[model samples]
Target: MSGPIHPPLCRVDQIMEVMQAAFDPAWGEAWNRRQIEDSLAMPNVFVLLVDSSGDLVNADAGASGLAAGFVLARHAPGEEELLLIAVRPEFRRRGIGEALIRQLAQDARARGAERIFLEMRENNPASSLYHKVGFEPIGRRKAYYLFADGTRMDAITFGLSI
Candidate 1:
């Protein structure tokens, strides 16, 4: 007898689609295809992709739905660092980001992570979302992110004890 089908996990191409739609070019926060590919190849790296309903997707298989957002993170000895996260612009303010973070925390804890950390530009509006998710500002790097136009932004690091 056949078992019930499960939606396929998020893939790099789907993540690239969301990244292309979600990130503004001026911020330069999105990763290139090669970077994502390389990161996924690492054993300690993980990714979660979700649709509008906050479910995993595989468009090619016509299961669930197209990917609406994704979170990529890396695990260390006792910590997990949220490396990247993005949701399609049209899907913003709909709790997709929060879903990703919550899911990431669950997965990280499973991997033995005791703390979760992330760094973002000071001007990024997503800080509020991180705060809402229980992350607190822990540190900062002055003039850390240099834009192509010669502008610089401070990077604020947030941490949460999982």
Candidate 2:
């Protein structure tokens, strides 16, 4: 007897596909395949991918469709960290990023997380989205990020209580 086919809960290919199109190379913000694979290997880490329709891509649907956006997060007791989130450049301003964050928040809350935290380089365009989603700047580290051209930027930390 043959067993039923089950799709992977997270697809790295789809994540990479979106990442390549979403992140600017100059920022060096995109994670490599090995980083993503290693993160996903951890028990407390989870990835959520969304399709063009802003629907969750899971085992039951859109298993092979390219992801429009993805969010990766790690959970700790009573808290979760938004490690990375990206949407294809063409998909920006279409609510996909918001959808991903909302879904991640929902999932994090479901996993017993009471708050979420994330850090971004200064002047990141995503600041608006973070603010719109109720994430408040809680702290900052000056010259936290060093670019290839020897430029440095502060890293702002934001937090959201679920």
Candidate 3:
């Protein structure tokens, strides 16, 4: 089922919690308090999500009010890069992640961006979602992500012209 996804205004803390939980420590590093604080301070940053009953969903409990997923983006000059996108584990296989990406693309276009970009771990489970939404691999970074377990993973950069 489709749900309304909008830019979160006062739910930054909740979003950060969910993001950290959904992101695997073995695949990529999770955002720290300081990083989240900095990102929220930037005007170019946008955090969008499908909140449950106008409340931020929690990542710990399966039924946390902050259910579904989230998408984070930041504008840079001529393009907007999707910095992060995550759906609750129980919410997977649904279209929540795809919807978030689509909304992010639309937001990018609305902001005069000619293209949208994102980087995913080489073996990220969400890679299929990115590809399905028209993102194509345009570049790669060797050992770009340092996981929490001290392992490194290559990053695959994907882009789509809006």
Candidate 4:
């Protein structure tokens, strides 16, 4: 693989593209533009993204390269919650996700957050990355994610104290 990936700090308007790149339709994890917009409108919401376009030299110039992966999170008093994190299907397994998580943790700590929390479907393979970054299982919400075909999956919650 190439050297470690360098991700850009995404602008608010650029969230949807990176989000779409990072999620799979089959997993039902993709958030629509409206939902993302609404979330971003909330106080203390932040986003981290990787744009691989290779041409991005300025983040404020709207030419910050192409979308690769992203993480959306919310910071409340003393805590930060990772609401969504995704790597484009083509970008998986290359450490983009790990970089995003690591940076998010560091950013949260810098902002005075005491801990970080994230919840995902119990079967999500990305949980391994979380574990590798020092996150530990804190709780589970039984049958929290319901499928379209009448099936359900538990929601696994992980926590990392900074």
Candidate 5:
């Protein structure tokens, strides 16, 4: 927590752990190891985060040696999509998420992407974080997310011109 938060090139195992913690099955589709492995294998996909010393933080603090935050993204031929950004619940409001966003935007720009986009549930708490990092809601998809209870939620698509 003392050192500056910076994005580290994360391994597949680390990415899976963070994704599991961030996206529970009840909340949404839980990404399995194979899925993560495939994502890591993709030429355009990247999984990265700020390492808290030797530990990997996801978005909250529960495990030792890792902070609680991560950023998953994919850069296609001309655009980039921020697939996921998660900080452990305990680590919220500590600027870790913001740092991750900034890093992703920089990466996107470096990849020659003119625009970056992300989709989140309209009611997601991290929407403000996206806004703070220069993302603006440009579109919406009705009933884009489904809860375990069979209810649906709207997906707000945010975009930033890089």
Candidate 6:
């Protein structure tokens, strides 16, 4: 972690590894490998972050600059949706999430997008990070996220003008 973490563009499997570390099975928020493969197959969809720092690396991990945190997004005619964004458990609060958010905004702007939107569980603590990056709460869906433990959380939608 010497320099600024500029998550390199990576393949689906590489990104999925990061997703695995970033999400817990109980949360029901992590996307599976096949889902990511299917997503990458679609047009106008792409990944925009991979933590190459090796800060969370172990002897068994490969040298693909594995994802510490990453953003999966889709761009349409004039807007984009941040489908998912996550930072590995050990990598959280180290500026990786913030950097990814900043980069996603730049990427959207590059596509001539008017703005970017994202939705997350209302109980997600990262809401502060979203707000700090200039995202405004635009809407909410009641009990949008259901967990295996029988609890449901509202989905808070946020928007950031590009």
Better of 3 and 6 by lDDT: 6
Better of 1 and 4 by TM-score: 1
Model 6, stretches more than 4 Å misplaced? 1-9, 52-65
The sequence of per-residue lDDT tens digits that candidate 6 reaches over residues 33-124 is: 87887777777786765554534332233435556777888889899899998888887877887777787777777788889999999978
Distance from true position, residue 53, model 2, in Å?
Answer: 0.4
Who is ahead in lDDT, 4 or 5? Answer: 4
User: In order, what is each prediction's RMSD in angstroms?
Assistant: 4.3, 4.7, 5.0, 4.6, 5.4, 5.1
Superior candidate under TM-score, 1 versus 3: 1
Better of 5 and 6 by lDDT: 6
**C-alpha local distance difference test of each model:** 0.82, 0.85, 0.71, 0.74, 0.70, 0.75
Instruction: Report the lDDT tens digits of candidate 4 across residue range 15-108.
Output: 5766666666677887887777777777688776665532222354554545677778888989999999877677778877787788788888
Q: 131, model 2: CA deviation in Å?
A: 0.4
* Residue 66 lDDT (model 2): 74
On lDDT, the candidate that comes out on top is 2
**For candidate 5, what is the TM-score?**
0.80
Candidate 6: give the clashing pairs. Answer: none
**Model 1 off-target regions past 4 Å?**
1-10, 58-65
**Model 3's TM-score against the true structure:** 0.80
What digit string (tens of lDDT, one per residue) describes model 3 on residues 47-110? 6666533233433334335545677788887899888777777677767787777877777777
lDDT ranking of the models: 2, 1, 6, 4, 3, 5
lDDT for model 5 comes to 0.70
The residue pairs that clash in candidate 4, if any, are 53-66
Candidate 1, 8-66: lDDT as tens digits: 33376788999999999878888999898888877778777788877756444655436
Q: How close is candidate 6 to the true structure, as a TM-score?
A: 0.83
Instruction: Estimate, for each residue in 12-112, the C-alpha lDDT of model 5 and write its tens digit.
Output: 55555666666656677556777666776777787656554323344334323554677778888768898877766566677878877777777777778
Worst 10 residues of 5 by lDDT: 1-10
